[model samples]
Target: MSAKTATARPDTSKPPKKGSLHHVVQVHYLFTLPILIMYLVFFIVPMFMGIFYSFTDWSGLSSQFNFVGFDNYGKIFQDDDFINALLFNLKYTVALVIGTLVVSLILALLMNQKIPFRTGFRSIFFFPAVLSGITVGLIWNELFLKVVPVFGQTLGIDILSKSMLGNATTAFWAVLIVNLWQGCATPTVLLIAGLQSVPKDLYEAATIDGANAWQRFKAITVPFLLPIINIVIITTTKAGLTIFDYIKALTDGGPNKATRAVGLLIYNDAMQGGKFSYAVAESMILFILVAIVSFFTIKGTSNKEAGDA
Candidate 1:
């Protein structure tokens, strides 16, 4: 009665032999080793070094420095320029995200329709994305400074006759419009791809069920595009927060520092003022803010997507 048959279990105890497929597969990892090393050396190392410097008083050119604990971080909060920059960044991010999302989604929907010359239209809209932000800004800056005034004079319109960048009240809108023009292109392409991925059958069924255009969009299109929308939100938020080239080219944070973005501030402080450690501290705060915003955006979208599923 005590003599029971034992079933033999397959053995995974032995390691793969040399020259085995498993070993060969592992060798593939070696192909990526160089890239990994480069990333560690160039990016990770510098990031840590910057963080270390942020806690010290390094004038960037100085060979010697002193650690000042949280002095930089504490000073940043008390700085009025920093506060103004932070507020402007928040305003810019909100406007950029909203405008870009809405305009991109609209353009995507239009492009997705069976319209004449859709490909040409798509190309035209996406062309702006290929141009550098600085280039675009410079172009638009000239247009606002020169071309628009001519049109305004011809039409006898006062507001249109002046360079918007030269006015504090209109500078924000001008910057926003320029950013939206270039920024909408990539998001439009993304939303188009997302739109194409949605099952046509769902729309057809919804139509058959007497769902109106808005209803169908709300119930089906929105859910399918949630992931792409989330991506657009996070990316645009980051771009808006770290905006520099455009401001540099367009206004240089001009019109009484009305549009001094955090990125530009960091650049000016580090390079122009030689306050490298302070700039690093600003960058760290910017990084943390971006991380928090991205985390919440992803978490909220993922939850909604999961609930829909």
Candidate 2:
């Protein structure tokens, strides 16, 4: 026993190695490297290049070009076509955002009820979102051009057979309608999720308190769904701003460019007229517009939420 009573010494010579910290950092870098590389290569580089080229008179295909400074931007503002196109895009964004939100919310409410074949109805509503935007546009074009006429002939309704893509006013509305049809599906799905997340107990309590359906919805559902509504509006606005495929397919920014949006205008400027620098300037404007809109929309919604809270 006496021989085994040796004093124990503390081993405090060096700090413990942070192997776990190193592992965690390595894991994070490994996970993020690919995405960072992709962003640098695809988005960051192109954006800088576009900005650089915007100051120069580069016609895309040619190597020989000269610096033009703010001339392209000045021309963009002066061009009636550009102004009209921007206005058209703004109108399109407003119309699509409002229409899609309202329609999708209604559909979500209906589907949330105890209806027959709810899954089938959901699928029917969402099927359009699965189709390519160009495909949906083309299909709607045919319907407006061919099927509408046949249906009108059968029913003897002259208004039903009119060329939707012919006149400026009608063409704009036609594109808006097609956009609503194609885009409403995703918003509906989102609204469905939001609706489902809402507490059923709130409705039950409201009913017990002698509240009518409209009062309950106004006081409860709308308040709770505000976040989702904001999301839908932002998504639809961005989509509307950058809309190209459907416009290209359905109207080709035609009928005197009445239905043209910003994306389509940029594409036309770059590809058709060989105005690469001009298009880049237009794109920069668009990017600024989208960034401002998104920031304000999000900030407004956030402020509303804070006020309500």
Clash number for each model = 0, 0
What would the per-residue lDDT of candidate 2 be over residues 32-66, giving only the tens digit for each residue?
99999999999999999999999999888897999
Report how far off residue 229 is in candidate 2 (Å): 0.4
Instruction: Give the distance in Å from residue 80's predicted Cα in candidate 2 to where it truly belongs.
Output: 0.6
User: How does model 2 fare in lDDT?
Assistant: 0.87
TM-score per candidate, chains pooled: 0.88, 0.87
The TM-score that candidate 2 achieves is 0.87
lDDT of each: 0.90, 0.87
Q: What range of 10 consecutive residues in model 2 has the weakest lDDT sum?
A: 3-12
Regions of candidate 1 where Cα sits further than 4 Å from its true position: 1-18, 21-26, 154-158, 304-309
- Model 1 quality (TM-score): 0.88
